[model samples]
Target: MHLKRFTDFALRVLIYLALHPGRTISINEIARAFDMSRNHLLKVINELVASEMIITYRGKTGGIRLARDPAAINVGALVRRLEGQAPLINCAEPLCPILPACTLKQVLNEAQHAFFEQLERYTLADLIGTKQEKLVNLLTNHVAGGNA
Candidate 1:
């Protein structure tokens, strides 16, 4: 299944913070590292902070950091929060007359649930694991505001 850019960017932002965790990382720095627009990243960060997934600080020394330990934050839960009530297929919406006989929708629903189930087994910590150094450097050396 295809994830929206918002969810995709949010995951990247979380992973970066999970790997860093040393100090507050600037949105500009993160945008440069990921080669993504600071504006876009800002929106993603806002959503994450609103959901309590990450904490943001203002002022010159202020930046962003994860709200909790990466190991305790489930990937599936993050996805669900970031996606904000997305259904894998529009057909999954209730009250649709075709749902009773729509084999395609059923199959897609099953697949989506399976995907989420798999995500439930992992956390931000799992995603960063041994790759912390690589990810940190990747973020530090990010050019301008886009993915490296």
Candidate 2:
């Protein structure tokens, strides 16, 4: 199943913050580093802040930072929260005559559950464990360029 752009952006944001740790990173800076839309990132950031995954600060020197440690952020839980309850397939559609007898839906459901269970075993900390320096340099260099 393909995840939405919102979920993708959320994960990217979390990973970026995980790499930086204590530094307050700005939305513009993140957008620039990822070459993503600022408006889209803003919406993602709003949801993250509301969910208490990240904290925001305002004013001249203001920016955003992780609400908790990377190790404390469950990747699966974050995906579930952002993805909502949308099913992988529209099994209830009237167009499909074999909806009742088809095992595809059930099989897909099991697969999806397994997918999340696998993700549950990992945290944001696990994502940036060894790539911290590379990610940090990539992000900081973009910020240091002052092009955002």
Candidate 3:
């Protein structure tokens, strides 16, 4: 299943913060780094803050950073939070003739469950482990007016 753009951006934001660690990054900087709109990124940032995935600071010198260690942020949990409670399919309003007897929904549900189960096996730390140095270099270069 394809994740929405919002979820994709949310994940990107988390990874970006994970790469930076202690550094407080600005919304504008992130926007520029990812070539995304600041307005769109703000919405994602707000959600991330509310979900306690990241912390925000105010004032001129303020910015954003991860709220906890990367190892503590479960990818499955983050995906679930970002995706919310939306069902994979709207079987209640099914237009198909065999909707009532369909096993598609059940199969899809199982697949989705397995997908998340796999995600749960790894944390954000696991995501950036081998790529840490490369990610750091990319982020550093991106912030310094270079391509990521």
Candidate 4:
């Protein structure tokens, strides 16, 4: 199943924050790092903040940081939260003729459960394992070079 752009951005924000611990980072910095739209990034950041996945501060010295440890943020839970609890497929959305006996939706449901189950086995830290320095350097250089 395809993930929404918002979910993808949220994950990227979490990964970026995980890479640079102990310091607050700005939306502009993250936007530049990923060559993303600041406006879109702000929307993602706002949702993440509302969910308490990340914390924010106001004023000139303000920025954002993770609300908890990377290991505490389960990938599956984050995805499910971001993706919502809606069924993966809507068998009766258009009034399908087999709506009364549709198994396709149930099959899709099982597959979605399996997908999340696999994701639950990992955490944000798992996404940034053994190469934080490399990721940091890549992001820093990408920003420094003003590629976007």
Candidate 5:
């Protein structure tokens, strides 16, 4: 299943903060780095803060940082939180009459499980490797270009 862009952005924002722990990341800096709208990023940041994935500090020297340790975060848990409760087929509000009889629900649920299973294989730490700088630059450039 294709994930929403919001989920994608949320994950990116989290990873950026996770990788840059101890550094107070300004929304402006993140926006410029990713070339995203400050207003939209602000909204995402607010949501992250509310979710307790990140914490916000106010005032002149204020900025954002991860609320918890990167190693402690499971990508699957974060994805689930960001994506909200998974209901891939929405059988409760079936889009088609056949949805009641279709095996699609089970299939979709299995796929969703597989997706989480794969995501659970790694923590934020797993994302870091020899190509970290390259990954960061690529993400920064792409997002800044409004391409991600």
Candidate 6:
């Protein structure tokens, strides 16, 4: 199944924060680095903050940072939470003629479950392992308006 942009952005923002545990990051900085819209990133950041996944501060020194350690954040759980409980196939939409007998919905649901289950084996730390410096340099270059 395809992931929504919102969930994708949430993962991106989380990864960025995980990599830069050295300092707090601002929404503008994240948006600039990723070449994404600040307004959109703001919504993602707001949800993260509301979920206590990341912490935000106000004022001139204001910025953002992960509230929990990278290793503590489970990728599967996070994605499932962000993606919500929307079904893969809407059986009620227009009323599928075979809705009563179709196994496609059940199959799709199982596949989705398996996908997230596999993701459960990983954490933010796993995503950046052995690539921290590379990711940091790339991100830094991107923020500097250079190709990475």
lDDT of each: 0.82, 0.89, 0.87, 0.91, 0.79, 0.89
lDDT (tens digit, per residue) of candidate 1 on 1-148: 7778998999998898887776798898777677788899999999999888899989999999999999988999888766665556676455678777778866887888888889889999999989889877655655523444
TM-score of 1: 0.84
The better-scoring model by TM-score among 2 and 5 is 2
* Model 4 residue 11 lDDT score: 97
lDDT comparison, 2 vs 6, better candidate: 6
Question: For candidate 4, lDDT tens digit of each residue in 31-111?
Answer: 888988999999999999998899998899899999999999999999999998789777767788988887888899899
RMSD of 2: 1.9
Specify the poorest-scoring 10-residue window by lDDT in model 5: 86-95
- CA RMSD of all predictions: 3.2, 1.9, 1.9, 1.3, 3.3, 1.6
lDDT of 5 at 15: 79
Scored against the true structure, residue 103 in model 3 reaches a CA lDDT of 97
Error of 2 at 113 (Å): 0.5
Q: How many clashes (backbone N, Cα, C below 3 Å) per candidate? A: 8, 0, 0, 0, 3, 0
Model 1 pairs whose backbones collide: 33-142, 34-146, 34-147, 35-145, 35-146, 35-147, 36-145, 36-146
| Better model by TM-score: candidate 4 vs candidate 5 | 4
lDDT for each residue of candidate 2 in 44-120, tens digit (9 for 90 to 100): 99999999999999998899999999999999999888877676888667568888689988888898888888888
User: What are the TM-scores, per candidate, against the unseen true structure?
Assistant: 0.84, 0.91, 0.90, 0.93, 0.81, 0.94
Worst 10 residues of 4 by lDDT: 85-94
Residue-by-residue lDDT tens digits, candidate 5, 1-148:
7877677777778778876769998887777666678888888888888888899999999999999887777788778777866678676663677865889888888889888889988877677645568877776777667654
What count of clashes does model 2 give? Answer: 0
Q: Evaluated with lDDT, which candidate comes out highest?
A: 4
Q: List candidate 1 segments past 4 Å from native.
A: 91-100, 140-148
